[model samples]
Every structure is written in structure tokens, then in C-alpha cells.
Target: MAESKFEQSLENGAHQKIKSLVGKWKGTSKTWFEKDILADDSSSEADISSILDGRFISYDYTSSLNGKPLSGKMIIGFDIPYQKFTFSWIDSFHMGTQIMQATGNATEKGFSILGSWGNPEYGDQLFGWRTELEIISENEIIFSAYNIMPGEEETKAIETIYKRI
Candidate 1:
């Protein structure tokens, strides 16, 4: 007898890779607005958990931005039918009133998601955002981002280095 693709994915698939992120972590994050110029540095905490019977990973995190409190929730999963990773995120600081959605796949270390952020004042694209992650080990991870704007060169917006606590 053969098993269905859905059943096979549920037991062993890309979702397993996403599930590896579950844990508690503490780290430091650096924010930049210009090339090689550090804008801010702050401490961060990550609380990751598996939800809906291991179908999705929900991560909650906290930190500070420019001396104010910052928090966010990130949900990640693998869509078996689509064969790509899915991500939905929202934060108290960056997202004004919108949820940032992205889709990408697992890399050698972690995963990267490319998505657009910001709404046009008159219906035009404002900017693009890419979130990249690398899990060096079970206890250590690196997360970074690239912000793309029209005409201007790409820039690193934030980089977070986290370790299990």
C-alpha cells in the first residue's frame, strides 16, 4: 500500500525543518539605515512554539527599538501543495497597520523570504523587504534583512544574532 502525499508531508517534509526553530532564545540585534553604519543595537528574546499539531510554527519575540519597546509575532509553515514555505508576520514597530506576507524555501542553513512592504500614497509600490535566516546550530542563528527601494541601492536594514537561552 502507498501513502498519500499529504500524509507523507505531514510526517516528514519541509515542515520538519521549520519545526526545528522551536525554543527559547536570547540575542542582540543591530539596525542600520546606511551602509556599514550602525543605527541601533538592542537585546532580543524569542519564544517559539509549534501550533496546530506541528503544522505550523508560531514565534513571538520582544526587543527594543530606539529606546522604545518592540514586539512581533511570526507564523511559518510549508505548503505541501504549493511546495514553498509560507510566512506571515506583524510587528509593533515596523508594520503600521498591515501584515507582512512572504514565501520562500529552505536553504542549506535556514530560509529566506522575499516580500514587499509599504503602501503607496496613490497606488504604487513603495519598497521591498527580504528576510533571511541562517541556523548555524541548534543553539545559534543569524537573521538579517535587505531593504530595496526604487533606484537606490539595496541596504541592510537589520541583523539579529540569536542563541538558545
Candidate 2:
């Protein structure tokens, strides 16, 4: 029998790279609600681990927003058939009662995924959210997110730089 693509990935492909993210990380998070305006800057911690036999990476992180406690969990995986990265995220502060599902291809340094959300009260208008995860070195990583309004440019919403702990 021939080795499956996913199996190949697990052995020496994207999954191998994903495994590097499994560990404890401590860092600082910066958030912005308005363009060019910093909102909250606080310490954050993340625990990442391989789940389901290294098929996916689970990221659970805790931080603060405006002096209030906030946390989020994310599941990231590579889709073999689609050849893209997929992620589902839910956070106490930004997500409220919703989960964001995103998909994208790999970037030069890492992966970038995009998702969207809208409120019914807002009359079906949706906004885009893009998240990027970049591994700078064996001990350092940078995670960032952008907010995209309809018919407008994307703006940086949050950025977190983490170091292995």
C-alpha cells in the first residue's frame, strides 16, 4: 500500500512543522480597538499540544483585556485534500458566543487564515478577521490578528509575541 498524503505530512511535511508549536509559552499581548491606537497591553500565557495523534494542534491561551480576564482555545490543522490550513477559534473577549472558522495557505514564515462574522442587528453586513502565526525561532513566536471592515482596509487588532517557557 502506498503512503497517504496525510501520513507523509505527519512524517516530514507541514504536520511536522506544526508539532514544533506544542509547548508552553509566555508572552505579551497588545490589542487595538481603533486605528493606530493601542488598547490593552498585558501578559499572556499559552499551552499548546498535539491532539489526536498529532493530527491537529490545540492552543489554549489566557490573557487580560482592559484589566478583565480573558481566554481562548484554538484548533489548527492542515487539510490534505484542500492543501490549506484550517482553524477554529473561540475567545471570551472577541468571540462572545460564536466560533470563527478560517482557512488559508502557508505563508513564507508561517500560516495565515481568514474568517468573518456579523450581527443580525447589523443587517447582514459581515466583517473579516485574519490571523497569522509566525515562528521566528526555536524559542520565539508571533501571533497576530487583523480586522477587516466591509469596503475598507484591514487593521491590526491584536498581536502577541511569545517565548518558550
Candidate 3:
């Protein structure tokens, strides 16, 4: 079948939005295990790139957590067929082998994705997960994660502030 006009164009708005993230960023991540107690804090570096002819944004980052190597990769794409923003994330940590994914609309500042991280083989999840990616500017971004347990308050588990290098 002939490719749709969107697939044929590399200059779409979503593509451009993804393009804006292509750069190196220096940042720090704060992981909280308790309400106010200090937990793991680490410096991080992110190298984002526009790949697959601007159809997707590749995000790769590395940091040390508890003196062990921690790294992750995320692919951000706009699904033309479904008209939704698509994303998949994998990491050396955070569930180990679960390829958490979510689809949502793009916000003015950035995007919000909601998915679950649990036993990959099981159906229901122990908790729900929400990921927010907000752009502060061309120079900065915020990545935050929240955990939702039934009949409990939404708890913020992780947040990383990235500034372009």
C-alpha cells in the first residue's frame, strides 16, 4: 500500500517536537523511597536523538544508583494511524524486564503517558504508573513518575530534571 501523506512528510509538527529533544542533557535525579527521607541521588546524562527519519525520538541515558550502573532507553513516536503519541521504555532497573508502554495525547508543554509495571505474565497489576514528560524550554525538561495503588494516594517515586548541555 502507498504510504499516507503523514508517513511521507518528515516535517510534521510531532516530528518537529521530537526533533527539539535531540541533544545532550546534563541533569540530576532524585529517587524517593519515603516521604521526606533522603534516598538515592545521582548525576545523569541524556543523549537524545531523532532517528528513523524523524518518525521517532530515541532517548538514552545513564546514571549510577546505589553505586550500580543504571541505564534506560525510550522511544517516543506519534502514531499516525491511531493519532496518539506512542512510547515504550526499558531500563536496567525499574521492573528489570518489563517493557512498559503507554499512549496518550500531546500536551502543550509535553506529553503524559499512563501504564502499569507488574509481572509481565500476569494480567492485573499491583499498581498503576503514570509518566509525565514536560518541557520547560529548549534547554530543560522534567521527567516524573507516580505510583497509584488502589485506595491510596498517588505517590511520586522518581523525578529527573534535565538541562541541555
RMSD of each: 1.9, 1.0, 3.2
The 10-residue segment of model 1 with minimum total lDDT is: 4-13
> Tens digits of per-residue lDDT for model 3 on 1-165?
986656554555666777889999999988876666658889999999988888899999998788888999999888877767888999998858779887887888888787777764565656677788899999999988887775687788789999999
lDDT rank order: 2, 1, 3
lDDT of 2 by residue, 5-104 (tens): 8789999888878888899999999999999999999999999999998889999999999899999999999988898999999999899899999999
- Name the best candidate (by TM-score): 2
Backbone clash count, each prediction separately: 0, 0, 0
lDDT of 1 by residue, 30-129 (tens): 9988788999999999999999877889989899988999999989888788787778989998887799899987788878888878776725866888
Error of 1 at 25 (Å): 0.7
Error of 3 at 77 (Å): 0.8
lDDT of each: 0.85, 0.94, 0.83
Total backbone collisions, model 3: 0
Give residue 6's lDDT in candidate 1 (0 to 100).
Answer: 56
